[model samples]
Target: MIERPDDAPGAGLSFDYAGFGRWYDSYRVEVLDPALVEVEAVVGGLLRDALSERDLARIRGPVGRVKSKPRAWRKLSHRRYVDRIDVVDDIPDVIDDLVGIRLTCTNRRDIDVAREVLDALPVADDGRARLWLAPDSERDYLDRPRPSGYRGWHVNLGLAVDVGGSRQPVSCELQVRTLLQDGWGELTHEDTYKKDGELPPLVEVLSRRMADLLSTLDDIAEDLRDELDRLDEAAVTSAPLPLTTETEGPGRRAAQAADAAAYLGTRWRALDRPVDLAALAWELQRDHGAEITDDWFGFGTFKRFLSSAVPAAEITTGRNAYILPADPVPEDDAADDAGADEHDGDVPDGDVGGHAESDQTTRHGTTGQGTAGPGTADEAEAAVPAAARALHRVDRTFPLLGHDDWTRLFDHLAEAWRRTGAQPPTDRLARRLIQSTRDRSAASGPPLAARHVEAVVRDLVAEGDGVPRPADELAGTYATLVQQRLVELRLIGARNRNARAAVRRWIAF
Candidate 1:
């Protein structure tokens, strides 16, 4: 327990501005400021990241504030310290709301998500979280409203603040509230919360009545949001079924494989882009009441892929494995080329490789090499890698094909074959479509479309349903689509498995 001074009720320590001000200023500069920065960086950042742009649009702010000298003095002068916090040593705990970070969400779900982000925060390497919720510090005003009708959720967060050179533990408060609740609180904040004295009967009754009405509004908004989300979900899940069906061929194999999403390439499966260990650990602790450090290793996965190669070699595998090749393959020209252009097809961060790209720039910007300033076409051609130049040769000769362009061409090809009982002259059709797409590439379509290839086989044999359609050459296209779908499904399955495995590891931890 902190030994606090119990000064006189009237004007005691209130008039001594210099003494209080000096302490307050030093405390604010040294302790409060760093704690605020730490909380905002860790808590505020995580909350904002948890919410999408749509959610953020509805949310007001993760805004912060510091308690003034008067508020701190008022709380400290109490006979027993507010929550028995040390005023001199633990100012942040004493003035729990010394640094207030408010995230006023428009609805309840966003508020819930914001709180979950903090509640499930993982501890750092020092066996501590940079900012953490202090025990017994949460106040659910919304669930149990105050007498004066204020509604909000608050959790006091302890921060590991680094003063001049040493580590100082400090704390702040995080407030989450719906827009309506925030408005109600705003109206009654001063009247209800500030003064220690009792409020008038009329004011008290009206405030409670107003709060109940706004609470009703908040509930309605949440229901409406849930309804809208269900509708959107239903629409997305209602994608068109596969174009064709097959029973006794590659198409059938593809159909089965694609449906399972469990047969993608081994390398792709292994590299399901590892999940955040901290997040995984946090989830484990929250859901299962198991604590674990955010440390994950992929040695098990590595052994699964490459252990067979060294079974005959006498080696005892430990936590760390150092594997050397029994026979090194000689590097040839093809290998050299492959190595040089290994990352050629890769999509850089923020430069996604897909159609439906609007105002999109490639690894090479708008006008290939445009982002690389002041270079003539000849100069660019000279400077550009031979591999890259070769990669783009086909695109320069042929016009880029958008999703619509490919669909139209495919439809025409099928129609042509059906009418004549023979493959049509795709050269003329291809030429015409290329020109059409080229003319409108800038005006109406993605400029870098067709940089990658993907075939979706939903809706080929319009009559297939789930049964195998008549064996036709056109059905071969459907087979190809099925093949593509199988690969995609495998990748998806691998990712799902990886996620599950990650969670399991955390659970074990």
Candidate 2:
């Protein structure tokens, strides 16, 4: 039996050790349900203590993937235990990173605050009491960084996972890093380090040099953060004091409402998943717009507002589920000349959100905002142009995923999501994103990109569309998905964004 890793209320309570007998065993996926549980349970605890929006932004991962099968085998094949029984009994210690939740921040100050919060984790039994943390479980990379220049804060944590209706103890690794540190990893292709080989001497030397440079940048970033904090404090102090009628004036109230709506609207639109209520609340309060929505956010007033200008059904998964109001009808501007100023090169009508092909999916018993209902994938797939499907294929040796392909693919995904009401598969999308990132030796440094990969995967898992991708043939298909994402910027130079940005980086010789 695995010993308890921490003193959380139900840590490691009668967990099924036999469940993880092999890397590819049936329970491999089953055991992963806890990783999902660990991400939110931990992050939410951190958020409850955040004093400001800047503090909230310090922790950006909704969560990333549970380590994949191929990656797991690479990790344990010779590194930990060779036999299954030894591995299963001491699971928490052997696989300390089953669920890796990265908290990427702007500066190191955020990391200090996060460490303080971790001192009193919210208990999981009912999300209330403080879960006891083992003081020795923390690994501080900053104090003794890897010679390769790697830097981050790591900690092993324990929590109970619900498996087959039984509460079982599980574990996760919380990685706290500043954005600059993450970016250095991305630019350096550091993720491939998990695959078990030292980098070529030239690459390693360059990576180490960049790591040192990034460390200096981290110091500069802290200085910039201190300056910003001072400015923010100054603004609050210098603000006009509230009088009998000054604080909540009608004009002030309207401005606040408009500001919050616009900020949240744009942010939600950019994300592939929902923003946490705590994060939303903090930002709203910072902007002085918290009450403009409602008093009790826990009731989902802001949640409904967040979905769209109109009310939408809450997503069963407990993240944000939204229903956008229909596009406003274009008015005939009383003159034909109103159209004269429009660009002739305006994305062709069928080229963007208005694809005629989506109509086919809509007609196949799918409503603009109704569930595609489990069987709609086939219908949705069949409805898309064959050329669109053809473009998903990778050349393996050359860049093949293109802009037009991405345009149609996004258009199709947008339509499927719109007609079916189910969001597109973002976890697979994140995997695809990670794959594409790994394939690009030409991509930016490894630090930030790696962290972003972790951050995006976390949110995707929390949201719906849990499309499971096989770990086989990963090398062949790696670049296909991320290249599409690079081109997913609403079709404005996105194609070139991937191609052009590749050479734009300055790597050390």
Candidate 3:
């Protein structure tokens, strides 16, 4: 019988092929290698195509990899079969994560969205190409996390591929997690610590603490997204355009700005990430003197322009990465200031090269002519005190921050009140700002730093007057006039026109 079975598959009669490394290599080269690429491509394409452009922008990566042969061998070696067999013959049964996809998104919402998309995907085989999707392989790890504070959604897909002229089922694990969760996992590598042995007491405690904090930050991100959604709905329904003006010149400018805002709002609404379009339009007009007329704001032109101009939300795994909710637009160039409020109403024409109209202006000061020119005027303008520049930047950044953030900003402003060399804040908002700043200082550890004070001031100026609308409309009209008193004291300075105007506008609000 032995002589007759000399050339049989498992002729050597050992399940552990310790000396059959060459046969394993032959199997890898002949069968597994080609199938790896096919399986990976099919699975990866299915997962990546499920999300739209907007969702894709928020997520970081959808990386894919195939399990290596040595790892597969180690897995197979751990198994004890009832009868002797060839290692290559048993490779298919033991390997599960031979092909894998790891999807890392920016936030919790995206991870959830991915989960839904994967659940509905149809699985297929290579040769006969049968299309079928079977359930019961997914684990909801986010909802039911491990005792070790690990959180992610794991999906094991059983796929069949044509390997060596036969249909073979391959198991692939797909893991979905937020960027933050993935970062934590990489920092405290489980293989290095957990797999090695029992965790040390201090390391265990720190890991739990880190997990809790990251989880809280994730919750905060989710809440922030919800708040933004509420804000967008409010903006579309009732928030009035901020471009109110009566004079023909200002009114024309206002109309142009409104059109631009409307266009942007409509486009973003379709993607479910609407911004405060009115606020954005107002800042572009008032700060940079941008001309958002029909020629420039047309569908074909504006969409392409905004895609490049508007900065996207920067996603990161750190806590301090939030640099205000919206992107900041630079202040207007001097050339644009030369044609301020020009009543010609021509809707100026060109290739629409820049956001603001370009022209030559006298530099020293405002000319007797209606428009200001470049020269010493621009030099003087540029030489405005650092405080004014700082304030302008703040206004640009914070014009639409929430009311609570503004309140915290007011507290900081009061702490720096003495530094401004102006009369102590007497108006209700100013007094409240100072009082709150003091109260917070008393409660917290230390007074804010000089840079922080400047940041807070800019945020206050950016906010202009209220959380959404004017203070009276949003907060029932406060009695204290903070910015009005500051203007009366001339603390904002007239060295910079934009800064001075922004301070006055806040007073009006």
| Number of the top-ranking candidate, with TM-score as the measure | 1
lDDT of 3 by residue, 48-76 (tens): 55444445556654566666655544444
lDDT for each residue of candidate 1 in 436-476, tens digit (9 for 90 to 100): 43334434433323221111122332313323222244335
For model 3 the local lDDT of residue 444 reads 56
Candidate 3 deviant stretches above 4 angstroms: 1-36, 47-49, 77-86, 123-135, 164-166, 191-202, 232-241, 245-509
Q: What TM-score, to 2 decimals, does candidate 2 have?
A: 0.43
Model 1, which residues run further than 4 Å from truth?
A: 1-17, 80-90, 122-128, 190-193, 235-509
Clashes (candidate 2)? 19
List ranges where model 2 is wrong by over 4 Å. Answer: 1-23, 83-93, 122-135, 194-197, 239-509
The lDDT of each candidate is 0.43, 0.44, 0.43
TM-score of 1: 0.46
Quote the positional error of residue 501 for candidate 3 in Å.
61
lDDT (0-100) at residue 60 of candidate 3?
Answer: 58
**TM-score versus the correct structure, for each prediction:** 0.46, 0.43, 0.43
lDDT, model 2, position 387: 17
